[model samples]
Target: MTLASSSKPSANRKPTSYESLMAGVAAGAIEGAITYPTEFVKTRAQFSADAGGKRGVMSILTDTIKTRGISGLYSGSGAMIAGNGLKAGVRFLTYDSIKELLRDSNGKMTPGRTVLAGLAAGVVEATIAVTPSETIKTKLIQDASSLQPQYTNMVNGTIGICRTEGVMGIYRGLWPTIMKQGANSAVRFTSYAWIQGLMINFTQPPSGKLSSTMTFGAGAMAGLITVYTTMPLDNIKTRMQSTGASLKYRNSLDCLTKIIREEGVQRLWGGTTPRLARLMMSGGIVFAVYERLIGVMTSL
Candidate 1:
């Protein structure tokens, strides 16, 4: 529900909490799977200097089909489906839950601190549940020529990593993932909450229910902000993760400087095409599903 709607909760038009949460998770999972092709291509372009870091999205897509074929485009689809879905689910839950707590404590939500609440939610999801999957996701997108010992199965390769390294091994790239996502979350959750506030203001409710369109719009706006703000870190984070944990620049800061010196400043934005598309589509789907799921659940 939009913040405006929440301010004046009523018995008749209440939105269902369960429906909202489920909708987002399901949408994020499905969209994450379908968009895996784009994400894989994006990952390859960002990480593989051999792939010609400057290749256009079209070229990358075609190259993927010609060389690895369709299945290759979704090499890490399984992990993404699970990871992204969980990320979306937890992020939403945390965001709303925190907002509720804050409101209860302070009387009402102030838009000025919307980003703070969002940062709280993002940190929780990224650190606890999403980090491992994200690290694996990066490895899965590397070029076959560049595939490392741990990334052989791409996204599914983490199964072996877990067997060998235990739970900790899966998080080899956890720091960078945390760094990237923490910053990304600041942008995403803030924008989402702020936009939701705007929507509520524009469409003040007779009760507490927001139209489905408002939820989608808020999600998309929040997504756009997050993707653009942190896409550079995201690119570097993916590259570092794909590299063998033993090899590579040692840590996130090192990975940052190396990419800048070697690939030039523009390299940070590599694979932005798919990343943008991924966020826009997935963001809208996630929010819509999240809100609707809760709505339906409440209805039942």
Candidate 2:
């Protein structure tokens, strides 16, 4: 949820915790399912070259399809759907709850408060839900040195990880994930708020109803800004999560340092195109669906 601009008429209806939670689950699952192939492509791209020279996005996609078939692109989608559903549900629920608590006597949420709420939401999701999902998803997508698969599926992979690495193994990149998600939420909410304000002023829609087109466009822009701004952290998070041990780097800082020193700074932006592709639609779908769903639920 976003802070209503002065020019845009506020519905003044807050969704109940259940409504917000369900809407977030629906929106996040839809977004994840629709955009998962791109996510798979991106995860594969982020790792180091596999004895062959570095492959581009298309090569990775094509190789996955050829070797593993079309299903390869959806390797970790089950885990992703569950993970994203939980993450989004908790994030919106926490964000809205925090916003409600922080509202002024006028019953209005300020942009700053919204940002802080988003930060808290991101941290909560990262710590509780995202890290495990990301770890599993990355391992599933990463090409193994062996010809045979290490883990048969998400369930097996998760079990194997826990059995071998324990709980901490499943949460390998917790810090980077938290940092990435925190920055991601902060940038996304703040930029979307700023963009929404500008759009409301610019279009001046009658009755203050924002056009779906404008909302989607704004979401896309916000997604771009958030992804680009946090690409480095995301890259580090991905590497740390995908790597089983400290063969290459010991920690997040070491990962960052090694990536810059060994692979050059530009390596930090690996898989950006696929990530952008996934998130552009994901961002738009999430906000648009969420806003409409919440509105409908409120009216009911």
Candidate 3:
């Protein structure tokens, strides 16, 4: 049970690409399922054009349940449950691959260099997986005007977008998604690395093992920072992807402008609480499971 460190690549065994990918996928699936209700709330809040101001998380939750039924709390979760594995797998696999190349003579990446790697990984994942998944999820959640629904499920939602808007439609928020993912990963990885380094130095366990609590704490803090810093971009991405032809934002910038003009600047921070809560838990679970699984699988 050794604490994996930047300076100790050999001392701390690493997982293979396949192993890391699988570990990430497994971890993401678990986290996504667990935190999906909060995510549903977050998306709904983001899409709410005239929230007046920051609404309470519970109020949003209760309203959603009352209007859309309890099932509404899980609207578009199919995409989340389906794509989160690929999203997280790509994120970890790409991050590790890039970080491996960036490690210095001591097999260590400085916090700054680690942030670069995280940024790269986030960009790659967003381009390959996140944009499409989010597009479908948002469409299903926010585009449905009536009880009939625009998308009955993920598959049809994806098909409908493709049929109507072509391939480009499914990637409507690609730029914002990349920016958000890059910034999110940069902050998350940098903070986690700094905190984990401190934890390793302070504990210095006899067996060189850092406990799960340490990993979870580091990840939670990192997630909180990411959520706070990237909420505006997240809001923009959601609005752009979900609005479709109705609002017809030209791009992320346009989306931001329209939201501010029509809804006020405060609209950009909608759903902060649920998003923070979900990501905090998700970050802890994702990193802890990823690290633990890496240790277990590599040993085997």
Candidate 4:
């Protein structure tokens, strides 16, 4: 059921901050766990220096399974699952808060306000949860691909990175993370709203809420838009967060320059396929689950 499907006006009531946070946490965890294999492949592709030829998603998946076993596809899933939940909670909380603040006297948020709220939420999540979690996740994936893995698990990897590289090691890709996340949420939220609005206008469901199918379709479209627009930033973020990033590239810009100069412009989209698949499903899963949870919570 969509948010607007309730017969009573109270059923359509906006979610409270706590509701948003909890719903987001559940939604994020579900999405992360379900789509993690694609995420693992995407990170590997992004960090790989295969200038001679780009590997397809299937190739990477088969290779990882062949060498490291099927479980290898989930190498850093622990960090991703935990981090996805936390960051999603923060994201929804911040976005809802800012959206409330930006609402007009009529309690409507314009597209610009929505974008701003999403951007703010993305930045907040990136700083608080995404950077560290992603850094560890990237390192773990990279480690798992090595001949002899250094870190055994998420906890051990976190401690190992800190012990050797200090606390900042876990925040290796701070700048690019912020940029990527900010743009990601902004584009996603804006596009989702726009597409959902169009769908609602066309369907005009009796309860005023879109069907689950429509909501998922709208979200998937938003994810598709987000993937192409933000792929380069994502590549840069992965590169900066990977092990030995400090030695390989000076900063985000330098990383961009080197990838283009050495690997060609198309290399910027190294992991587009896996990332696109994950995010397309991610958008649908996250919003659908969040909306369902919010519906349940608000009703109670």
Q: Which candidate number maximizes lDDT?
A: 4
Colliding residue pairs in candidate 4: none
Per-residue alpha-carbon lDDT of candidate 4 for residues 124-176, written as tens digits (9 for 90 to 100): 99999999999999999989988999988999999999999999999999999
Candidate 1, TM-score vs. the true structure?
Answer: 0.84
Per-prediction TM-score = 0.84, 0.93, 0.91, 0.95
Q: After superposition, which runs of candidate 4 have C-alpha atoms over 4 Å from their true positions? A: 1-10, 50-53
Could you arrange the candidates by TM-score from highest to lowest?
Answer: 4, 2, 3, 1
TM-score, candidate 3, is 0.91
Q: Per-prediction RMSD in angstroms?
A: 3.3, 2.1, 2.4, 2.3
lDDT for position 155 in model 2: 91
| Tens digits of lDDT, candidate 1, 138-202 | 65555353534335564347776677657776676676777777777667766776677666767
Of candidate 3, the 10-residue stretch with the lowest lDDT total is: 1-10
C-alpha lDDT score of every prediction, in listed order: 0.69, 0.80, 0.80, 0.86
Backbone clash pairs for candidate 3 read none
lDDT of 3 by residue, 114-161 (tens): 889889988998998888888888888775534577777788888888
Name the better of 3 and 4 by TM-score: 4
- Which parts of model 2 are misplaced by more than 4 Å? 49-52, 105-110, 143-146
